[model samples]
Structure formats: C-alpha cells, structure tokens
Target chain A: MAFFRSHVLVCVDPECLARGAHDVIDALQDELVDQGLIDEIQVLETSRIGGCEDGPEMIVYPEGVHYVGFNADDVPFIVEEHFLKGRIVEKFREMPKVVVDEELGPLRPKEVRIVLKNCGYIDPTNIEDYLAVDGYQALGKALFEMTPEQVIEEVKNSGLRGRGGAGFPAGRKWDLTRQVNDFPKYMVCNADEGDPGAFMNRRVLEGDPHSVLEGMIIGAYAVGASYGYVYCRAEYPIAVETFNIAIAQAREFGFLGENILGTDFSFDLEVRVGAGAFVCGEETALIASIMGLRGEPSPRPPFPSVKGVWGKPTNNNNVETYSNVPQIILKGAPWYASMGTERSKGTKTFAVGGNVKKPGLIEVPMGITLREIIFDVAGGMHEGRHFKAVQTGGPMGGCLTEQHLDLPLDYEALTQAGSMMGSGGLVIMDETSCMVDIARFFMDFTQAESCGKCTPCRVGTRRLLELLQKICEGFGEDGDIEKLEELCEEITKNSLCGLGQGAPNPVVSTLKHFRHEYEAHIYEKRCPSKVCRPLIRFEITDPACTGCTVCARNCPVEAISGERRQLHHIDQETCIRCGICVQVCNFNAITVE
Target chain B: MTAPSTERDIPALVRAAIEKHGAKRDALIPILSEVNLALGYIPGEAFKEVRKQLHDPTEGVFVAESQLHALASFYDMLATKPRGEHVIKFCENAPCHVVGGKAVWDTLREKLSLKNGETTPDGKWTLVTTSCIGLCSVGPVVLVDEDLYGNVTPEQIGDILGRYE
Candidate 1:
C-alpha cells in the first residue's frame, strides 16, 4: 500500500491455466476494472511466479501475501479481500514458499550441457532469445555458407549418432534420407520420449527449443527439405508450448520464413503432438502418429527416410539426434568428434534418475565409463545404499549389473553388453528395489502405453505383464520363467515396431542378472526384497518386540494385537504385508523373513 | 500470432531495418527478431535505427543478441507464464507435495492467485493442475516460460503471468 495501495497479479502459467488461471485472470481483472481501481494499481502479466507448488496462486505486490487452494467460488473472495479491500487472505497462503535466485547452480548447466545448452538460457517464446545464443549460426554455416554435401561430410566427421535408441550415425541417416529419390521430402524431430524415467527430450524442448529448431532447420538443409515436423507427446505440454513458441518466434524472425538469413532456403516447422503412447517413439509409429493415424509401426523395408510422413521421403530422428546437429555444425566436425570412444563421438545427455544420489541431467563424453557417470558424476547410489543394477535406455534397454559397471557408455559398447542406448533414461536401483519388481514395473509401463497396433507388441507386452503380475501376486510357477523368456523373443521378432521388440528388455536383463530374485519369488514362494507385498508376511517377533504399543495403532488394518505394556504380536491372518508395521517398529521388532 | 505472408516493400522495409537493426550491425538478434516477427522480414529502412541501437557495428563484433544467429533470439519463449487455450501444468520436480501432488492440485485451485472454477470473467484463461513437470533435479519446480523454475515459492506466484488475450 506504500506506492498506490495494493496490487494483485494473477498467475497465468500453464500450471495456473490448468487450474483455471485464465478464468482467474479474467475474473480478477474485470473485478478490478469494474471496481474502478485500475489506475491505482497496475495488473501486469509477467513471468511465472516460481511457486507452482502453490498453483492457481496469486501474489499481491508490495504486501507480498501468498494465497493458495482456491475453489472457483473463492475467486471473488480473493479479489475482494486481497485486491479491493486490501486485506490479506490467510487461508490461501502456500507453504514452504519458493524463490528464484539467478545465483543457483545452473539454469541450463555450463559444463557438458551440449544438448540443453540453450534451453532455459533462451526464450522459447521469443525467437530473439534463440538467435542471441547462436541459435541458427550453425544453420547459416550449413546452408548459405556450406553445401548439403559439405554438411553431411561434417556430420560424418563429427561421428554423432542417432539418439532415438538406435545409435545409427546421424550424418549417415541424413545421407540415406538425402539419397532417397522423392519430392516433398521431410525432416522430423522425434519429441516422443517414451522410455520410462526418461524425459531428456522434454527437458531439451522446455529448455532450448530453438536448439532443436536450429538442428531441424540444418537437417532440412542437409536433406533438401522445406517442411519439418516435431512429433512430441501430448503429455509434454511444456515442450509442445515451447516448440510452438519457438516456431512462431522463428517465423517471426527470418530464420524460418522464406529466404532464411538472406539465403534462398525456406523452412517451415509445425508441431504434431502425440498421444501419450510409448510405442509411438518408434520411427514408423511416429510417422503414423504424425499423419493423424493410429501410432502403428509398418515394416521398414523402405524405412522412414525412403518412404515416411505421408509417403514423402523423410528422415526421422529423436529430439536428441536433431539436437546434436547444430552443435556438430557450429563446433565443427573435429571439435564435435573430439570426445567419446573411437566409434562413438560427442557427449550424451542422460537423465540420471531413480535411486541415485543426484538425480538430474548429466552429459558425459561418449567413451566415459558407466562407473564414472554413475559414481563420480551422478554421486553414486541414493543414501549410500548398496549399488544394484541400473535400467538404461528405457524398456528396450537392458539392465547392467555391477560386473559391467566399467563398460564404456558408447553406442557399440552398451549394445555389446546387453543394453541399447534407447533414448537416455537411466533409472537407478538399490538393494531394496526388487529386480523382478522393477522388470514388472517396466512391463506394466510398456503394456499400459502400448498402442495395440500390432498383435505381438500389443498382446505380447500385455502377456508378459500378465505373467509378471501373476508372479508378483504369488501365483507363479517354476515354468513361468521359461515361458517369459521364450515370449521375449516372440515379441522381439513378431512385433511390427521397435516398441514391441524392446518391451521384453527389462525382463530379459533382469533375468540374466538377477535370476535368483525371480527364483525366490517362484520356487521359494518368497520375495527376497520383501517388496512384493503379496508374497511376504509381516510379523512382530517376541524377542525383538519391545512391548511398545507403537506398531499396534499405526497398523491401518489393526494386524498387530498387543496389550499396553507387553510384547506385541501380529495377527498373521490380518497382516497385509504392506511393510508399514515393519517401518513403524524402530526396534526392528518386525521382519519380512 | 498468424499473419499472411507479406510482399517485400524493399526500400521502406530496408529503411526501417537500417534504423532499428543497423546499430549493432554485427549482432542485431533480439530487436531484429522482434521487428521481424512484427514486419515478417527485416528491410533496409530499419538499418539506421539498428545502427543507433547497436553502436560500433564497423568492428564486426556486434552484441550476440544483435545477430541473426544469436541463440536467445531464436528459441525465445518465457518459461514462467501461461500459454495456449488451456494450461495444464505438472510439478515435475521432486519434494513436491511428497510426490502425491495433491498440494499441487490445491495450488492449482489458487493459480494466478485466482480461485478454481473462476474464469478471468472473460472466458480467456483456464487453469489445470499438473504433477511433476518431470525435472526432478530442481525440487518443487514449475514449467512456465517453457522453463524449469526450480524451488518454487508460493509467494512470487502473482508475478507469473502473460499478456495473452
């Protein structure tokens, strides 16, 4: 109230929009105008007010009062009390408050930030933010400055490969796509991040949309194409919005319109948002999804480059692949190719997640050992827990045990072992996490996300899930393992798309490494980790139980029967194996075994 | 945001272009992007303005923002604002409502400091709740401006906004 009374600024971010921000803005603005207070206070539409946790949140300037949890009915109250009346609405204040400081570690990361270098650093909504950070410098170099053949040559020199789970050379893919004889050729950036625990593409889009755009434009120049599409998942609203903003911004700038940067080349980019389906990441299915059809995979004789995206010659690469293009061109083939193993060059950005100490985004040189990435860079296992296996590259990617920790994390090195670089999702696992359960979790993810386009991927992923769910539910037979193993191959070969083929990866990797866990679930009829709730029984031991009634009341099912001062006992019949009782007893009174 | 393709008005366009973007002839990224977005293309008319905005263009070292290849000028989008017909945001960061995201929903109720079920009274903005925008590195994050706003606070919320009609 110091300057000119109180100011109420509404949150207009997607978080707010989803929660009725638009309505709030509309109602609040009108209320202010109708109340004739427009001149006294200024209601400006600024950037996001950090506390998304306090969604549909509004901040009153000068006073700085936070309001939270508003029903539509509460809008008038907020406006009247907070805005018109200048009274703070205490009931709507959000907790623990969030503040944004520029001094924080890294907005887009400084070192090894290759793919995401410009995400947060630039404005995806403004094309200028992109160009300011050398957005299309590489495109300029590749297009007006260099020939298409020269661009491909630089790619081959860089040794950058496809990031779409396949490790094919990006330059080679461009070469193939370019070789394909057709008009109306197309270039697509696969923003479909289907891998479980993988959101690297979404991050890139949210952070540096123009990087992807610049890469696509360069790729288009290389492949002799005029139109490009980014097939992103609808679940990736931020990425979608960012790309949309980037396109508009680019078009507004000279980068995307006719005669980009004073050159004869013209490229227009449109975004095609995908249904939240895991299988759609596969090139063929992605093409289908882009064409406004069901995301089903077709045979790959011609591949997407020869015939794809409405039967036009197309080059399909995931967001990362396209992301690498501008870097290669801008940094030069030699500079880009300087890192990694002999075969695999450039840095790969991995979404280090799961039971890891530092779960974020890390970009490692290609040849860097997995141990370096996991232990040195990722800060090792969570809470110093004993290292278990890590599930890499999503469902199609296999789990690597401790023995393979030293393996080089390049294209061939990973494939040589068990895992393929299926995108860049790295989910960490600890001792407590059951290997079979992890496999089952992935199977569930794939099964639920399957498009049901082909019999093998649709039915096979479901069947595998059914078997795992059965095993976890305590109905597993010894022979089920063999059947699951066999079905893995059937799905791999029979499925039309990569999704079906890769669905069995988690199961196979787990089986190859942690078969004992499965055997325990089957033959022993016990879960080693005690995580599979149905198989394990929780009980309080007489020796360990300390006559403390703590566990008795905490048990939601009242499974524990105990007197006030005597040793407690779990009613075996009522025990749910939920592990809450075990967790409650600090004295180690309860045990799964 | 959509416009029909404009035919070149070379002299006027170039004049405007020279006036606005010619100052930092080496780098006319940001303003050029804005003007280009407005005018569809940079014309010679803006060169004089450009020369004034970006001084010392003869050195061939323009501010990176003044260049066609400047990164920010191309991939420019605000991360902390609502966009589109309807906005559905998820809190992808960890430590957010204990991963349950119920509080995120609660916050959604009060988004833009506006209450749930309340339209801007103009049918312009709609709000939705999101759980985990998926960047766990920054706990309690919100994806606005196409950006990962880390460690969000409920206090600065009203500041997040857009002029979108």
Candidate 2:
C-alpha cells in the first residue's frame, strides 16, 4: 500500500461540478480510503478542466493523462484497471491514448497546456490539493521573500490586463494605488457579475477562492492597503458559500489576518452580498452600493483607484483578475506575460454558451480564434448547423458574423469587430436564428436591467425598444432603420455608465451584419428565417399528417381540428401562436410557411 | 408599511417597518428588500428588534394583515396539500403568465378553495406568486419542499399535494 507509482488529478470546477465531479470525488476518496492506500493515492479537484463541450473532465497526475466529459460510473474501471491494474479507460479518455516507448516518459505529441495547468488536476477547495501543485507557494514568495515594489514590478512586467473586459494593465493598476497619497486604502475583488450568460466569477470563487484571495493580499501589499472586500452577488449561493469558507480557512491558516507569513504586512477581507443589482457591476456604482447608497451610477473624476470605496484609494479587479494574482506571484511576470496577444496578455476565460456544440467555460490564450473555439475546441456547432454569428460580451456585447469567426479574440480586436471582450460571455448563434429578433432579445434584457438613472439609457433605450418591437411585429416604418442608428449613437454618447454606452451595440452590430433581413421585415413583411410568428404561418403538410390526433389535442388555442384517420388542418385565425402543436407532433407534417 | 412617504431617514424607516410588522426572519425578506431599496443593504443596527409603542399591555389591537395577495384564487400551488403554515416561492423568470400560465395557476387557486397567498384557518397552507423561479423549462413550475412540479395543471395539482402532507 505504501509502494508509490503515478497519480491522477481531475478538476471538479462547478461547471463540471454538475457534469459529475461529486461522484468522481466520492469514488476516489472511497477507493483510496477502503484499501488504506489513501496516503499513497493522490486525487485532486482543481478548477474547471476547460472541456465544456466535451467534459465531465479528469486528469492523471504525474502521468498527465486527460479524459474529457467523463462519467463517475467510468471512474472505478479507470482506478482499478487504468491506474492500478495498468490499463487505460479508453471510452472515458478525452483523446486517443498515446503509447510511450517505455524509455521516454509519456508525453503529448502536440498539445499546449498553460493558464489551466492546475485546472481539473487538483482539489480547489482543499488548500493541500492547491499546495501539492504548489498553490500558496506564490503568496509565500511574494509576501515573505519579495519587496512590495518588486511585487508590483513583477506584475507590471507580466502584461496581464484586467480580465473584467477593460483589459487595463493589472500591474499598473496596483502600482498607481501603491504610489497614491492615501492610507487605509482598500483592495476589492469585483464578484458582483451580472451578465446574463456569464459565470466565470462563480467558477473562480467556488473552485479557486484562494487564488483571488491570494491575489487580493498581494494587491493590498502592492497598494499599501490593510483591507480587502469581495463584493459577490447574493444570488450565487454556492459561490458565496465557497467564498465564505475560503475566507475563514485562509484566515485560520494565517494567510489573511494580520502579519501573513510572519511578515509585518496585515490584510483582511470581508464578503459583501449584493442584492441582485446588475448596475452594481460598474465600478463607481459598486462603490456607491458598498457605501450604503442605491447601486446607481455617478459621473466620475474620482475613479476607485484614486478615491474609491468610502473615498479611499481602492484597487478593484474582477474575480478572474484576483485569481491570476497568485499565478504572477508564483510564476513571475515574464512567465505570465509570455502567453496571449500583444495588447491583451495572458489567457482569458470565456463562458462559451448558446447554440454551440460545446457550451461551457473555456480558458485559452487571449488571441485564440473563434473558428478554433467553435469548430476545433467546441467541436463545431451542434448538429453542424450553419454557424451564423457569435455574441461576445453578454447583453451589452455585439454579435460578430461568420466572416469574423477567424478574428482573434483580443480586447481591441473584439471591440473593433463591434464587441469588446466584456466579461467574456460568448453566446454562439446558428442559422435558424433571426438576427433582428436576437438583437431585440438582448435589448429587452438590457432595458429591463437598466438602472434608469440617465435619460439616454432610460428613455432612448425605451424608444429603441419600441422601434425593435415595431420591426419584429411586422409594423416597421420605412425610415425606422435609419433612426435606430441615430438613436444608438445618441445613447452611447449621452448615457452615464458603461451599460448605457454599450446597450446599443447589439442593435448596431445585428443591423450592420443583417440589414437585409430587417429590410425584408419592413418591405416584404417577411421573416427570412421564418422565425417571427407575426410574419410566418404554420401549416400541416397535407401528405405528411396521418391525423394522429396529437396536434389537434395539444394545441392550446384549439387551432387544429381533425377526425381519426383524417387529415388535420390548422385554423390560422384561432391560433394564439403558442406552437404547442408543433412541439407535440412527432410527424414531419407541421411546417412553418 | 408603504415605503415611508418616498423619503425618510434610515433608522426611522426601519422603525416604520417595525411598526407595520414585528422584527422576524420571515418578516426580514420584504422589510429588508424595501429597506435595501430605500438605502443599500440593512444598516449596522437595523437588525435590532423594533418595539411596538402604539399598544400597551393595558390595551390590545388586532394584528395588521400583509395583504400581499389581491386575488387568492389565482395561486394554484397554494391550494395543494397544505404542508406547512404557508407556501412561499418566488418566480424569478419570464413568460409564466404570458402563455396563460398565470390563468392556469389561478385555476389551482380556485381548486384549492383559497385566496391568493392565504393560509387555511388551520394555518396549514398559504400560496403566493414570486419574482421568478429560475427553472424556466418547467416553469410556471411550483416547488413544494425540495420537489419541483413543472408544467403544472389544476387536475394533477391536487394529487401531488396529497403526497406532500
């Protein structure tokens, strides 16, 4: 039992948490504990393993074998046969098993792995799993070994920008606060992520809370601050739970409280729950919310770095930004700066969602192409459906057409293509989708979540919504399209915070890419994709329907009527457009015309 | 009770909440949400109990009703087998009612023979609509205990409730 061999580590990040990490953890623990070989067998639950499209992910430590999208039912065989009995779990393994010559250690012929080395290979919740792969060694180095100026200098050299979408220099932001004429300054981790389809913060917080905490402590040292705050959304109970646990554990381990690592520097962190406000994601509004004011935006001359959070010099970074701090401290700046594109350095985390073959969180080098993600990494669109456009940057982000699929996803490139890497929310859409409707859908989301503090965002977005409604409802005016462009410009220029400024991007980009579809909606009263109910009609193909009685019985509006063994016809006028009939019908008879 | 005339001091506002309703965790949700809206987050000492000054031990008055529900029959999930004293679930999604989900829900209310969000005199059942229950697919879905009932119907509603009790 004490005889040593190789080890296997699997990441159980929450995204994959649902996919089957719990069972994996349970199995690994049980198997090891049962034989009393628990001390010899090392299993880790690291952060998300990044095979969202094909993952209930696992990794083999010492050997570095990766299996993507595996089920725990496959674990026993993997442990007994692959690890112990000397056989591989072929069905569960992610890629083709490479055979080693027995002389050379098992090595991948061609595959690059960084930024996610610890992901899926260690237990993120356990500090020991993190430390086994050398987690807090970075904090120990930065705090006990390096000077504050040197820590800042190393980060300045890393070229890691704020992953919260703005891509500001992480080191410089710390440096500014460090040089500022302020005492009792604060370092904050911005976990109040409100994007509709984004959960990167949740993953980092739940899977690797210590990363962000370690980052914050280093940031506090660099900024000459004594306190840190993690403003997380109260909606995310799991994230909050893990963060609370991480904080208590870190403090208990002598990492977060006064004089960390036996140094004179003292730093403490507190978790503030946000009452589900979307606008509070904005830095200024977040400060206001923390200051016991409504989470509303105010004009800024005093940025948070200058006079923020109780009017003190504060360094605020997204959850991902904080997660990177321990890395830079451990790996050194040059190592961190080595990855990613020129302007946007290091790997970026993307919540790849929607109509893609693989819809989950992925962390790749900054300049990775959308084509590579969708076709290669994400395993292409689901069913090979004609890939239309991908919407990056949440509701406020713009949609890029198929032509731009090859575009590198850097901060500047995405913005130039009509979407910034706003919090890295990538919602991929397919051919069956209507771009006009997609634009309207995102606009409706933003309008509802808008704080309504400024006129342009408040009123202009409403007017724009009314216009999109007019277009979608088949009542668009001839000049309406031009006015939408005008309104977008006005709203962007006049709105107070980033929400209003970027709210119009969805409309503008969709219009730019799919204007002909809008023209069809106006001139021909036709929905090119035939998706809009008002512009299309459902008909039972005479030859296909066998009068099964399913459609006739299921229609909410009683739109269909048919006798047994007779053809069914839809009463168009009575139809409420519910489409229940279509869904209930197993036949190919129902067609939208 | 009605948000303090649109402008009030923080503690006075909390006191006003206490006047309308006693300090309690069950009371905490509505009172805290309102207070947080008026002022971001509950103040440091806001958790302190509010004492009622209007009625002394010498005299007593009838308790105030929350009146959260205008039409009780509209809530179907409330009518099911009365589990606890009340049914409290928030709707955190869209299109619950747009597809006549609300109307279908109302049928459950009528079947349960109760008004919106009212407990039976036995203090057994109270049904209420919420902001958005996140499971949109099964939406207009009701969560009774840990179980989620999706695409609910009035006829089937009673059968599910029978098991809960």
Candidate 3:
C-alpha cells in the first residue's frame, strides 16, 4: 500500500521472458536492495511496451524512459545510476522511435495521412485548433464556389469509393439522394463501427471530430437535407462525446446551424448513440436503430439512399468515408484520385494487429502490396516467426495467404483474391496461429453477432459453428469439410442483408485457402498448431525440465506434483489445459502434442 | 454504485427520461439508455411506464410494452435483468483470440467462477464476452465498467479484477 517514487515496468511478454527477462528482473531487484532503493522504487511487470525484438525491456517512470536489450549483467549499473544517482543509463536507453502517440499508436514510415491528417496533430475538443488547420475551409469552398450538381461531379471525378466494406461510389450515392425530391431528407453519419477489429473510424471520430462534421455539413448542403444524425456506437463513449462537442462548436462557428456562414444552407446534426448491435453497421439496420427500433435489417431493394430514417431519403456514409470529404473538397478531384489505383482512390487506414512486431494503425495509399503493409509497415511477424495468413476485414472478411502477399490492397484486387477491404482491419497471423481455429474464431463471432432477422444467418451460421466446433473438439466426420462448404454457399446466397451474406466469408475463404488444415483435423484428428484443446495434450518433457517446480506450483488445478529439484508429472485427468503452467515455466519443459 | 431502483421510482424514472429526451419513437433508445444508466437494468414495470409516458402525437408513434421489452433485450448494452455492481466485458472476437486471448479468457472465468453473461452470487461482478472494441494492437482487451485495460495477460487478470472491488 506504500506509494513509491518511481515504478519500473519490465516487459514480461513471453517473447521477452524467453530471452532472460526474469534474470534481468532478479538482477535489478538484487541491485536495488543492495543500493537500499528497493523501498523507494517499484518494479512491476507489464506486457509488450514496444520493441519486443530487443528483449529484457523495461520502462522507467515518470520520465517514461524506455530501455531495451539489457541482460542481467547491465542491471547493477542501471540501478546504481538511475535509482541511486538519478542519472538515466545512456547505454541501455531505447531511442524514441517515430513519435509514438499513446492513443493513435506509432507513426510508421509508409503511412499516408489523408483521413488521419489531424488525428494526433490537433486538439479534438478545441474548434480553434481545428480551424487553424483549415478545418472548415472545405465547407466554405463547397458553399461559396460549387453548386449541388458540381459538388457531385467533383466527387464523381475523384473516383473515391466508400471505405465501409462495400466499395460503392460515394458520388453516385449522393446523386441518388440528391435526386430524390423528398422533403426533410436526412444525412446520417454511420459511426456504428461494429467490425470487431476495425478501429479506423473510431480514431477519426475521437481524434478530429470536426473533419467528419465538416464533411457531413457539406454533404447535407449538397443533398439538400435539413437535419442529420451521427449514429455512433454507445460503446465508444469518447467518440460520441467528442462528436457532440464538434456539433456544438460547428453551430457556434456557423458551419452547421441555419444560414451557415450567412449562406442560407441550413443544416444541423445530433448524435444518436447505438445500443450494442453489430448488425447496426449495415445502413438499413443503422437507420432502424436511429429510429429506436430493434436494429434489424429489412429487405434492401429500397436502399437507405432512396428510403431511410423515417422512410425519407437518407444518405449514410461510414465515419472514414465522411472524414475523407474535406480533403477531397479542398484539394481537387485529380489530386485525390492521383494517390491510389485506377479503380480505388485515396489512402486507407488499417488497424493492423495480431502476431506482428509492430501492431498498430497504419494509413497507406491504395495499391500498396500486402507484403509492404505486413513487413514494412507492421514490422513483419513477431519474434521472427514464420508467416501464415492475414485476415482482412473482420468476421465478414476472408483470410489471405502468402500467395496473395504481392497483391495490391485495393477493393477490386482484394475482392478478386477472395477477400474484401472491409473497413481496413488487417490482422496478421503467424505460423503459431492455426488456420482452422482462426476460421472457427471468426465463425463464432459472426454467429453470435447475427441479428437473427433471417433464417440463413441465424441458423446457417449456427450450423457452421457447430460443424467447426465438432471438428475442433476431435469429433469431425469425413464429409464435414464438404458440408461446411455447401452450407457457406447457402448462407452467402440466401441471406437478406450484408450480415448474413458476408457471415460465410471467413469460412469460405479459409476453406478455399487452408482446406488441407481442415482435412488434417478431420482425417487425422490432429491440430497442426496444437490449438484445439481436445486434439492436443500437455506434457512435461524429462530432458528440458530443470526440476525447478515452477510449472508445478503455478498449475491452477494442482494437476502437477513433484518433489523439489525433481521432474514433475501432469495428471492428465485433472489437467484443465488452461496453459498457465506453460506460460509460467521458464525452461523449455512443457510441450503440447 | 447507486441504490437499486424500486418499483415506485419506475414511473418517475420513465417520466424524467421522456422529459429529457422527447416522447418520440426516435427518442426511445436514448431514453432506455438513460434508464439503464440510472438503474443497473430496466425493470419490467419501467417498460410499461415508458410506454404509457411516451406518446408522439406528431409521428403517431405509441410503442407497446412488448416492443419496449424487445428493444431493451436486443441491445447488449441495455440489460432487462438485474446485473452486478461491476460489468466485466472481455473481448471474445478473432482479433483477441489469435493473440493469446483464450488463456486470458480462461483465467478470467476461473478467477471469477462465472460463465459468460453470469453475475457472481455476491452481485459484485458480471462476466460477459463482447465483440472487439477496436483496441486490436493490444489484444486480449478487457473492459471493467468504464475502465478498459489493453495488453492483458493471464497473470494480470487478478490484479485488474482486484482494482474494481
């Protein structure tokens, strides 16, 4: 309960632990005790504070000095200088790499900051900071310079497709909504970013709320809409709060309310917090949720552009798509179109995660190869592990293998390769990741998040999950793989909305690429990655066991028992297979087969 | 936390919510969210109170109690049943799973002795699995009430849970 002057957080990630991080910790403790500074300084174990490759890493507070690649030998000097003398050890200090923002993650080399221009650069709450960066200039130009038809033409010339999974032309959507002579038309900003791993929209909404507001105001002006609603997820309380603040500020600055900037284009917006529903990401479902309905998607013959939000003409765009508007407006259409490929224009921001050395958000221009993104941007596989497949999108997206590494990351190229851009959530998997288990993981997500409006998504996804569960639990039949493929096709075809239609993507894509892994699970009853619990067993190897009894003491179920300095035995019957022993063990003693 | 809401306060709570957010079909979600925020969960009587108090003559939208219950149950955030003091939401999606989330999830279930969507006997903690909240870089993310902890390991689970109580 005693407060300490300094807290040293040592990285205890498995990769760092494997590289003698414990010895380093032990040395630091011994040195601190020897120096009589142990009482003043607290050493806490934290996981993955960047630079995992250079292990035995620790960060000193409140200076926030990061030190890496030091072993037990360097600990005494570190303690003597930093703790006692108040001098940071220059030898072990890790250089601040690339101006890492705590919220936005590290700024990478290949990142293009079009949508994320003011993300980490501006104070999101302050309107003056946004105005200093020419935030509302685009709105000004849109109102003063261009007509409604001309604005649509400029967007059409830019060749910017929607960033929200479906690559529909934004200009065409706006035109369609503009053409509808419906009074009290609506412009809804779809901020209900329900794609599990995708956070590009969240960052934008949280970081620079005005960008989205500016875009929405301009769109409302063009589409001749009086009122707009930003349908943000209630889960992201920060985004909703920030967006609400932005709306108020815009009204004050005359960017939003009636006769904005004295032009007679009257537009106002409010934040509609979505009650947790993944299907609400769909336009129709989003519209329904805004109306305080069950967030269930009906038939889409009449899209949101035609009839939406109280059965009036509505235009809905993803958060990222709307954020891109100001830049597209300020800069000419050709300037925006020049960055990406022929079909897809502008840079895309990806929430790159999973088994990568540098897992964070990266914005890269379109047509960049997957290899460049995974290797150059995300810093490749973690701990030099072998590459497996990369899952793009979320549950609705597919897994792409090494064969598609060189493929350009555009909408057409990705869709052609059995994957879609899907809000730019790219999760990189390594050799340790089991393909079957990965597919099952996504299937489980899609199955749970299904709105149950239709039979195919509600029932078909459940059946698919059951088949996957049967296979993973070593209860696979011979025809289970074929059965999965047939079911995926049925679900894909028969589903009413995008939720049901795209729910089979992970299964279908994984089946297409990693059918052999599924075959092995069904035919041999073996999980190659030793991930499926029933198919794999934990054991203590005799040679590698140092008789330390670390695993024995750490075992939650008391499954391991042995004398001190003797080899331990695991009681398979009692072992719950929680993998705690393996994580706690320092020696390479435990093996799963 | 605030004291549990009683049946007598249900009508007052519904009336206040209707006053705050207008008595329209579009205001139902915000109203329900406010009620959920005030009370841990919306009581069965509160739905009837809401239906009675909420009447949008302009839109001709007067929702039924059944419709109100349907909405309250559909969204994961709004709970119809009584919940624990602290809600612990663990990410059970693919992004977390691929990066050692299974072990953390297992450790959490073991530590709390509660399965998904179950509250403790003491009503101190409720464990529920949620889809990803976009902190993918720090996989194995856990949200306890409003505090979100990223880069969560099984070893850190006990400490995190202890912080809430």
Return the top candidate by lDDT: 3
Per-residue accuracy of model 2 over A1-593 as CA lDDT, tens digit each: 45556565667666777777788788877876776767777776677555455666777766666777667676666677765676766776676455532111222222233434455455666776766777678888887788989998888888888888788888889888888897889988899877755666776777677777878888888889998878887656677888888788788888888888788989997877665567888999877766545578888777888999878999999888877878778877878778878888778776665565545566778888999877776557767577888888877889898899888879999988888899877777777778888888778767866887899998988888999999989998799999999999999999999999999999999999999999999999989987777988889887789889999888767888889868999998998665667777888889887
Q: What is the C-alpha RMSD of each candidate to the true structure, in Å?
A: 17.5, 12.0, 9.8
Worst 10 residues of 1 chain A by lDDT: A101-110
Q: What are the per-residue Cα lDDT tens digits for candidate 3 across B1-165? A: 234436448788888888888878889999999888888788787787888777556669778888888898799888888888898999987778888898898889989999999999999989998866878877889999889998898889999988876
Mind listing the fnat for each candidate?
0.06, 0.00, 0.82
Which residue segments of model 2 deviate by more than 4 Å? A1-121, B1-165
Instruction: Judge candidate 3 at residue B8 and give its lDDT.
Output: 43
Rank candidates by DockQ, best first.
3, 2, 1
Candidate 2 residues B1-165, lDDT tens each? 113335646568767765554544223333544554454334333333222322234543221222212111111211212333435342422223322254456555765667655556765555555433323323356755446676565456778778757
Candidates ranked by lDDT: 3, 2, 1
Worst 10 residues of 3 chain A by lDDT: A99-108
Of the pair 2 and 3, which is ahead by TM-score?
Answer: 3
| Model 1, span A1-593: residue lDDT tens | 44667666677778877888777667766776877876676665654775665577777778777666675567777777766666777788765444542221353322376886765566677777767777788887887779999999999889988887788888888999999878899988888775645677888888788888888888898898889878877667777887888788778777887998888888887887653455667788778666544456788887888898879999888888888888788889899888878998888888776666666776777877777878887778766577787878866788998998988888888888888887777776778777887788678667766767688888888889999999998899979999999999899988876777778988998999999989999888889986777888876777878788888888768888878768888787888665657666889878787
Q: Per-candidate TM vs. native?
A: 0.68, 0.71, 0.86
Candidate 1: where are CA atoms >4 Å away?
A1-111, B1-133, B136-165
Candidate 3 clashing pairs, residues 3+ apart or interchain: none
